[model samples]
Target chain A: MARILAVDDSAAMRQMVGITLTGAGHDVQQAADGAEALEIAERQKFDLVITDVNMPKMDGITLVRELRNRASYRYVPLLVLTTEATLERKQQGKAAGATGWLVKPFNPERLLATIAKVLG
Target chain B: MPSSARPFTGASELAGLAPVAQDASQLPPALPGFESFQRFWDRDNGCWMVKILPGEYYVSRSEEAISTVLGSCISACVRDPTRGIGGMNHFMLPQDATQGPNDWLDPAIGLATRYGSYAMENLINDLLKLGAVRERLEIKLFGGGRILAAMTDVGGRNIEFIRNYMTLEGYRVAAEDLGGTQPRKVVYFPASGRARLRKLRPVENRIISHHEQLYLDSLGKQAAGGEVELFD
Candidate 1:
């Protein structure tokens, strides 16, 4: 089982992501926005980091950049999980060092499928 | 910048039996449901239409029906008892900010409407053109459910935005059914200024939220800002 860090400004979206990942046997940690996620990341290590794009204090794109700056997170799968699906936005995520991108409103099956692909 | 784009979009009229056509209708190149408007139809209601978020609304005098599904989103039905003109709007915080809604009021009236202020103005302006008087306007607010147990105060902020807007405008709210853990299905009858709200079950809420989130995700900054849900 992998340890995952799920972050979103939305409590509901965060809860859904946590439940889906945990049900799949992965341990999940959550944060409300990128700033909080960054603080969490500074101390703990996780197999994957999932985040939404738009949020207060800090956004997902910037968070990806910051996470990538850390040598320890160089190989961790940093996924951009958001409702924003534009190619430009996706490209931005990649430029920020995101490992993969998943659109929001994700379900258990689709989320798991994507996670499997990312982990592999 | 305070923006002026509308959040709720689509040709004001739905398919099945079209309402009196109007100018600048948005349904073109016709996205699946956009081609005909009527995604769902109910026989007894004359013809029924639905609104997606950030705010799609309509005013009707026929025996027609207007509806919307909510997930921490909001729907406001404004009617004129005197002129018998009314409409409903469904909107949420612009794109992903969900910040202090009132903070946007000063910048652009258009941007604020994507939240509540502009929705009220847009619907009220239409109602007035249809002969509705502010004093005779009846306002009813619905939705703002806590479907996302992990989210911040989005639902509460939406409620606060409208309330603050209405109060600032000196409009006495007729009624409201806000807050809770369930998303809502709201129906409004324009001719009679009557409305009905159903708290959707958890199963249905998840399905709808998933779809709406996809809709939100597919949006660009200006449009997705939830600024002009018409940006939808």
Candidate 2:
């Protein structure tokens, strides 16, 4: 099972992600916002990082940028989870080195599929 | 889904406003003495509403009533049956005296309070003046989800503020489901004092933008800037 880091500002979203990923047989860790995610990433190795874009005390884009700058995370998969599905934002994420984007309220199957494609 | 099979008129147009239905069998059984209430439709808003009225001779009952609220701000529900009336309010933010009176809600910031405790006190006093007894009052709280994730920590702050306020005021909170990623569509049945919560999936960016615009207008703020990016 892969160790995954899930970050979001909403307690409910974090709980949902933790439940879904753990049920899929992956070990999960959670952070309330991007800043917390950064701190956790520094202390441990994770197979994947799933993050929400809109958060306080730092955001997903900034997290992706910082993660990409680290040598160990250069190729590690990073997926952005967001409510925004705009083409422009997608383009921005791709340019910042995100592996893929998953929209919020995603079906469990869709989330699993995306995880397989990114982490497999 | 065939067009004719859709139950709502203007189903296509109303698609945006459609409510997500969950299986009732999956829910826990209702509490004893609590019956499911009536549901109403607001044609103008294209939304369904439910009301649960208090039962007959419920005066001896010690249970607190619960209600749901969904919006950018807070919803305060006040109940004092001796006065024989209760009401709920939805506000955008803790009142700021300097912001000028809210033209629509009667713009007196002094009339408003930043902390939920102050707000609750004001509400209780009003109810009391209307003949509500302080000792017999009970409250059910809802709403305070962070609609603007980027601009404020108001939702989290509001939740904490309310919880603490209730403790200091000696009011018992009978039931609560708060702090979530999704927007909620809440129903407060004043009569029976039960709140039903339905979690709403995030809508499209276009709709979000529309709602945000409406919110800004209500606050008397200019909406000229480009949409604030939700994430960095």
Leading candidate by TM-score: 1
Residues B1-232 of candidate 2 have per-residue lDDT tens digits of 7755656533224666443342433233332323453333443333334332211111112222333335444565666655445545444333333343222112111112222323343345445445566567657676666655556555665576666556644677766656665566655544455555777665632454355445544442211111222222
Model 2 ranges off by over 4 Å: B1-232
Query: Which interface RMSD values do the candidates have, in the order shown?
Result: 14.5, 15.9
Could you give the C-alpha RMSD of every candidate to the true structure, in order shown? 16.9, 23.3
TM-score of 2: 0.39
What is the DockQ (computed on Cα atoms) for candidate 2?
A: 0.01
Best by lDDT: 1
lDDT of 1 at B133: 67
Tell me model 2's lDDT, rounded to 2 decimals. 0.56
Q: Model 2, A1-120: lDDT tens per residue? A: 899999976554565567668878999999977999999999998999988777667778889888999987898899887655678878888778888887643234456677887776
- Residue A44, model 1: Cα distance from true site in angstroms: 65
Kindly give the stretch of ten consecutive residues in candidate 1 chain B with the minimal lDDT sum.
Answer: B223-232
